[model samples]
Target: MISIPFSGSKRNRYKEVKQIIQDNGYKKVYEAFGGSAVLSVNLFREGLVERAVINDYDRLFDLYPAYLDIKDTLIQKCLEAGFIKSNKRLNATQRAYLQSMIATIDEKYWRLLANNFVFSGKQTGSLKPLYFTYFHNDITTDKQREYLQTVQQMERVSMDYKAFLKQYFKDFDDTTMIILDPPYMNSTQKAYDNRYFFGLSATLQMLQMVKEMQVDFIFFNMIERDVIEVLKVFGFQDFEVSTRRITQTSTSSREDCLAYVRNHF
Candidate 1:
């Protein structure tokens, strides 16, 4: 039930993905591209996984210690600074205060709080001027406190997915499942920041490496021809899941494919 305001988060597809993992009887989950780490934490919480490793290239991992140690303090500071209270959009004065806090506060706290304010839970990974949004639903302090509790048991690491997989994939056993949710290979849109934009070549290289390693994995990505072909070449079983993309102007339905390789190694 922990909600992280991260762009491209898998929270919506968690139940489906969790069922896949559970059916495979995977007791440990390694979230190779752990954006928001929705699967890792929730799987651990629900007792599907005895161990979870959350790894991401983004600096968001740097804020985990802050959340673990001083979440109450962070919430209190936000409350005192008028950052949280209602489901209303920020006013001009409140915006000014938030801008100042982003300018002056330490990167860890500010970046963590920045997630709650950005439009559509999209992060830019910069201290640049932020596009503000309404505070409501899961973006409240009470919800944050509840969410923070779920992450305490997870092991967090900040590293490029290639390096992370190279280092740890060798240690995985039959009970381990590596969840690969890399950035979309067909989209140029920057989800979190420039660092998150994984080009087609890089995506192919990652897929090739995963194939060579012969480890069990569940991969999530948009239904692109090249990606589907590559997964097919690797002998993965494909399942397409329908999803919606919500923009400021409209919402459109799209299909996202989940490809998995079971104990075929």
Candidate 2:
């Protein structure tokens, strides 16, 4: 199995996931809930799958292509515009500059860096300093340019993912396979804020709709009793658990990892 390490895996459970999809005769697959799109990318890269169907409710996905295409151009502009230094400790003027940047610079710079930034990754827009500080020119200009160029394909790949899902899933049938990874409740997301919270119920409803039409799918779900009961009612019998993350990672004093889909998947 092609293992992409972007998200957590419990005891090689993802291996089982890869195997199930491969054995099902599904060359064209769907990622119904693509958090990072890592798995689809892995499958495409490893030649285990021929095409993909990736969808997420988040609108930020629309910006992925633009971000990839312009990533280096934006960084170069920042450097040319006087961005410099490492761990020099943001001084008053520099801090003010960063604050000002949060207001006018590209949103991509901010959204990607909010994790380790000052605002703890929840703030809206590019108002945090963490968004702008990663613009250091640590490598030769040529290398940085090449690296960003490589990422530029994300735009093309995203576009391809969108088109493939639209064209193929319009008539989803027994031949089609769905990989479900519905969002679970967590710190960065909540029931009302992110679609995954109360969204699970709605997503399950969607799954029911698809299943009724004879769509072959397996859910990698949060082992909520209600959700489990709902799946059981729909005749879903197979499951496996993976402990990706249970609660908010930043707030937990110590990791309180919860078992999800471990034995159930």
lDDT of each candidate versus the true structure: 0.67, 0.47
| TM-score of decoy 2 | 0.60
Q: Clashes in candidate 2: how many? A: 8
Which digits, one per residue and each the tens of the lDDT, describe model 1 over residues 150-232? 77667878787888988887678878888888777765553534545576666778878877776777777776565568767
**After superposing candidate 2, which stretches have Cα over 4 Å from the reference?**
1-16, 56-62, 68-91, 106-109, 113-120, 123-175, 185-197, 224-227, 244-247, 250-265
The residue pairs found clashing in candidate 1 are: none
RMSD of each: 3.8, 6.4
Alpha-carbon lDDT of model 1: 0.67
Q: Report clash pairs, candidate 2.
A: 65-155, 239-264, 239-265, 240-261, 240-264, 240-265, 241-261, 241-262
Candidate 1 residues lying further than 4 Å off, grouped into runs, are 7-9, 65-89, 107-111, 121-123, 126-139, 190-193, 224-226, 235-254, 263-265
